[model samples]
Target: MSRRVSDVMTRGSRALPLDATLYDAARIMRDEGIGDVLVTLDGRLCGLVTDRDIVVRGVAERRDARHTPLGEVCSADLVTIGPDDDLDTAARLMREQAVRRLPVVDDEQRPLGIVSLGDLARAGGVDPGVLSGISQAPPNL
Candidate 1:
């Protein structure tokens, strides 16, 4: 009797083009009130950039947000969950991957929605420390 990821995921249109700069990604996130956005290549999910990624990778490293492509800042490692997956699966993935957010995809890998620790918490799920670890800024910052 577990809840599906789709039940609590954020269904916002927040995907960005691969050619877009980090500044574009940040602005979209700021306007949309999202931490991360899915990056697309020819309308397909390629990677993702998050607020943490922006601060840690884009800012701390002195990468020029306006010139640095989102694809450059986005983690090359892509991880995802299905819309039908249970929240426990999402939580476990978050814990194991040390990621705060995950893109919800269908079998064909189409972008559906996004699930995050905050979404789970707002949906009455507990953080359980793992989520906090994911959100914490690096010590160097």
Candidate 2:
């Protein structure tokens, strides 16, 4: 019912190694003005680390932010979609997973780009209000 993910996805998401310190991820997020970043291990997709992850899993837990690797706290149970997949698939994935953002992957499950709820709305395939209500709606309102 819509274009492929690659047609609308924001390509080349900002990424960092799984071993990166929580401080490192936070710094990058701040510098990039992004809420989340793709996490990797040995140059492959591993998990996703968001600002909330750092706050709840790192700060709230009293972990050593400078020493703790993101892999320890990032959300590893990802819901991803292929670059060639339709926006319908993306919408369904978002609905079923209850996530606001999804990592678009290549055939080998390598991170290629990212698609957010807004992307679907912008694509004109889904209801904006409904998608916006999903978890992690952009803080800007």
Candidate 3:
């Protein structure tokens, strides 16, 4: 039987409200040793903000992290999956979306966990070449 996303996903994924500042997101990422945080609005998943997002969209643009809300810089075009989905599905979604992480959500769009490329690697079923491609450093701007 194929493993489910919940089997390897990182549970208790950190989340912050849309109004939360970039600094708040950074602190959570720092303290939790995570690269991204789910952005929520009224308890529903709304977007995602990564460390790179903060640096590129917030800091590079000279936006004050202390005051700039995540809503302003977060990637709202999210591609999420569900806990019961097969790991293969997650891997495919990650590949097709060109995203490193996928927020596992419930029917109500509440984030339950996050499945990362590393998680798929650890699960040991995804194509190695795909993982390698995803792991490659992003090209310079």
RMSD of each: 3.1, 3.4, 1.9
**Per-residue accuracy of model 3 over 1-141 as CA lDDT, tens digit each:** 999999999999999999999999999999988888999999999999999999999999999999999999999989899999998898887777778889999999999989999899999988898887766746222
The per-model lDDT (C-alpha) reads 0.81, 0.85, 0.90
Q: After superposition, how far is residue 50 of candidate 1 from its true place, in Å?
A: 1.5
Top TM-score model: 3
For each candidate in turn, the TM-score is 0.82, 0.89, 0.94
| Residue 126, candidate 1: alpha-carbon lDDT | 47
lDDT measured at residue 121 in model 3 versus the true structure, 0 to 100: 96
Worst 10 residues of 1 by lDDT: 132-141
lDDT over C-alpha atoms for residue 106 of model 1:
80
Range of the 10 consecutive residues with the lowest summed lDDT in candidate 2: 132-141
Clashes of each: 0, 0, 0
State how far residue 43 of model 1 sits from its true place (Å): 1.8
In the range 37-125, model 2's lDDT, one tens digit per residue, is 99988777889999999998999999999999998889998988988898878887787778888998877777998999878888886
Q: Quote the positional error of residue 132 for candidate 2 in Å.
A: 5.3
